[model samples]
Target: MTSTVEVSPAARRSAELEDEITADPSRFRILTGDRPTGPLHLGHYFGTLHNRVRLQRRGVELGLVIADYQVLTDRDVADDLETHVLGLVADYLAAGIDPDEAMIFTHSAVTALNQLMLPFLSLVTVPELQRNPTVKEEIGHSRQAGVSGLMFTYPAHQAADILFCKANLVPVGADQLPHLEVTRLIARRFNDRHGPVFGEPEALLSSAPLLLGTDGTKMSKSRGNAITLGTTAEETARLIRGAKTDAHRHITYEPGTRPEVASLVLLAALCEDRDPGEVAAEVGSGGAAALKARVTEAVNGAFAPLRARRAELAADPGYLRSVLRAGNARATELAEATLAQVREVMGTRY
Candidate 1:
């Protein structure tokens, strides 16, 4: 495990965030995943997935859960779940999440694992659930529609995912800090009652910017503003063309003043390895029309390799399945060990 005994605040936040969970480096594991609702977009890349790739390559033990069941809790968009999962798998592979290095499995496949949620639910209180930021945010976004029991109870399920793998580090954005807190609370409670069997996974926060969608809102596939990883070059250009930008008729990198245009410029800079301010100046030199075109070109160029890699992997569905199957087996090994520990802790072993 990398030590962060000395580093600047920003560097500490960015690269050396695992100091929180180095208490037992050998037992440290990373738990993270996508809901598999839609093809992963640029938002996920910058948000969490990119970091997963980096950490996994550096020998981080990771378990990615395909929260397929969570999709139905909110809505009935059942048609594309499988496709979305496969697409996500492809995205992960394309982004360098080696199947051998990390375990990737779906929620539905882990029956014994999901069973842990029942006992785990008893370990947490309703007040704690209500205090969770993720749950509260989901309720607020429901627009007065009654929140489902699953939505309220999903945190326990998440706890199952984390503790089942004995994960000690959870990569998350600032918004997800509450969910991690709930996981830690559950771990503490379970250990207090049972034994110190699970590690309290600390939040491995990222320094990457929380990217906004094309519409200047937090990026989400459901919001229709996302630029999915599966996006074609033409689609990316079209989104850039229609992306929300400031009306100053010139480009600038002031996110406060020109969020829409500035976001596009930043994406361009990220792709081109140039300064956003420089990109902004170029856009300002030209009109928004020229700026949008430049941004589009830069983005297309940047994602070209990833686009090709994803397409190649998508061509071989059997390869994707094999990867998931192997990952499922590996995940099961870790999960069964945790389950065995749980059974022993509570004297439930028959």
Candidate 2:
């Protein structure tokens, strides 16, 4: 049975805000990022990375945060944290995030940003934190016997991330609206308690098409089902060819009855910027093999340049480190200014 995903009231409000921002994209500052647990995947591309690139092209002041510290919230140890962080930098550059235009920094690297967490934490209560759906979902996924204090209070840290940069806009998916809501609440409370210091950032819902995993589930690296941005064209083709599809020979976009095949159709549609029904119709009785081939070709063609760029960027680790150093320096400057304003407003500037 096909289950319907319910749209929350927050998500609806976010959609309206997104429309308002769409009219004047440049007037707003955008802050978005990923956790550097692993290399980014096609899901990252369609979900937010592509939108970041587009926003940068439009001259938006974009702040990309690699939440490296958050990666340790659920885990006891991460030996390759530095490697993952650097890998994330390579992926962003390879994905067309211009270093000169956008400020990409690691979460831990910005000292003042991390310090803001303490003051922000005081503004939010445990019950309010508990209400965050994203946290609840993550806890459920981890299924740990006990939740760490860091994990429980990570939403506040996210508030610090958004508020520290003074970001007026944040790009997120519908499922992430609750998390954004928490950030908004913290901003409102902070402004109310101690003058207006931070912009109440609104969610810029990503318009990119959502691509399911090869196994017809949500794409995730942990699940070993994601097609990473770093994957070679040959490997991409192999993975797509191995993707799950319905036993029915005929191809159609019947998401309710034939979700597996429907997903491939959706991927093809997004890759070609065409309607899923239209693509399905054009593919017409070609069966799973033909549909898979089309999806493979579209995906490979779309990512060919990205793969090439990523390879070159990956080969020069020193260059990537220098980029990160530059980003960190830029981020620290902005963060220090914001934190100073925050301290002045709270009468703690001394």
Candidate 3:
């Protein structure tokens, strides 16, 4: 008998939702995107960008946010964000996101979207914000030099980003479920207090496994472990070569014990769209050199097309700016409509 594993409620619900979406995608709207703090990376590509392209191809409406203002949440790490936002658009285009279809805009550019934050904050209690697992985790970071107020109200802002476009489906990772729950609560409370101004959103949990850094920890740009999308082929190989590995000669996909090796293997597998087990077996007995070579080759080959597209996009900065402006205009229209509803429902339209 083939072995079987039990699925969780969230996974089952997500499956049902995907099936419903696949059958009638026109009825659904999706809001998803990235922070423009830095370059896109392999982890980000596998994590959500590819999924956005997949949904977009299926004729789904997408409101992709380049949350530039969110970079201030930390209050300490902000650099060249406007430039980074442009680079981010280039990456999105290179990764097959059609500018004509997806409404990609910076939240800071949308006044009405940010304005919703004040009303949204009223829907939730202080204890609830403090209780949000995701926020609590981020607040834990305040022990160093302390985080900014933006850090505290980030979930509300995130809810605004999602609900502003009246997006019903949000693509999130498992770790983000708690945060999404906060958004769901806000929507529920608002709808109950006022008229039906918003739809309760649900999560589309990514099937992509968490990709750890080369050092066997969370992949981070500041940590210098992330292989950014725009890194040169030579730089990619160098980074992979420096990845943490073990002395064991026979390669195997053991994430629990051999996390470093497993991360590299997973990276290669994602690059080539193969199973991690198969990737490990293919590199069996070849050791770290073989693993590094395979990962480097796979990553470089995968990114080659995107890199060329990005370079082409970079040459036309005016086109990139126009895309942002157009998206901002469209997003502003949607946000204005939503804000009008919010004001009317609250009887604060005077």
Candidate 4:
């Protein structure tokens, strides 16, 4: 047994400041959002979502925004919005993003966020949007109606998502740097035109290497390669068993020489705390069958806790609803505060 230590108010404040400084001495809020297009996958887990959980544990204030409205840029169907959003929430929860540590809210929940988009639009130019790499990939020129106004102005919405939360850090991939650059520009423009109310958030580029799907392409739901967090243990095992691997009778972890074996090696390494080289050596000695067996076991073991928690959470729909409701209220409060400042700066204040 150990004695509990009670901190004084001053000491508590100092400790809080120390924790924030430890996260980043510059003390910028972190804002990240995911479009509720589909359930999250392994790529998401190792890439950024894992980092989000780590950040939350490190005492960083996290705002996990569900970009529900952003879905309309490509998808016109409203038939599955509720299902998608709820599924996304389940995925997030399953991925260890505690609602107590992070505020999980949808874009549509905060109505005033839309109001911030217009002024942010004025701050960024057309050339900037055209230069965005993701926009190019997401909305290729070959498509009919090459781009919608919403798609064209997605940077503005991204800006709103960050500045609305007064986020100092935006975790993004290499392809999303341009989006953060635009957000930085908008922050400076707003500060210059109005006042120093917003801090230009910096991008926390993910250190995790891009994990491809089983089909040897991007791990996306559209490609059917994604192993969703909501998937059952049996399902996860089945997917891993059926996953593409090298045709080599024996296993070796040479990414250049054996891409398929290397892929499983990497996955096993990521799921377990073991090193890829070590796992590879083991597989190389034992062969592909042994590698597959260990890989399947590792995947299941890694996902076990999450799957159990998700089932527990799923059983109580009311609890999940309340959590989302609380998150929405907290998000609305923050968004409204930011919007009030925006209105003041834009001279919209009555």
Backbone clashes, each candidate: 0, 0, 0, 1
Clashing pairs in 3: none
- Cα lDDT computed for each candidate against the true fold: 0.81, 0.85, 0.89, 0.78
- Regions of candidate 3 where Cα sits further than 4 Å from its true position: 1-4, 142-144
Q: What is the TM-score of each candidate against the true structure?
A: 0.91, 0.92, 0.95, 0.88
Judged by lDDT against the true structure, how good is candidate 4? 0.78
> Model 4, range 1-350, lDDT digits (tens) per residue?
99999854434544565466586744646788788777788888888789888878777788888888878875543458777777777778888888886898888888887788988888877988877776776677324456777777888888898888788877776566777888899999989998887887866656675566776666887678978877877887777777777667667667777776787888898998888898887777676678878887888889889888877877777777777788889989988999998888778889
Tens-place lDDT digits, model 3, residues 170-207: 98877788888988999999999898988889999888
lDDT of 1 by residue, 299-340 (tens): 788788899999999999889988888888887777788888
lDDT of 2 by residue, 1-350 (tens): 99999886666776786666568767878888888888999888878888889878877789999998888864632668888888999999999999987888998889999999998899988898888886787778774687777788889989988888789888886677789888888888999999899778877776556578998898887778889999987888899899998778878898888888888999888778899999999887998889989988988888888999999988999998898888899889988999899889999967
Best by lDDT: 3
Lowest summed lDDT across 10 adjacent residues in model 4 is found at 8-17
Clash pairs detected, candidate 4 = 29-168
Q: How far out, in Å, is residue 267 in model 4?
A: 1.1
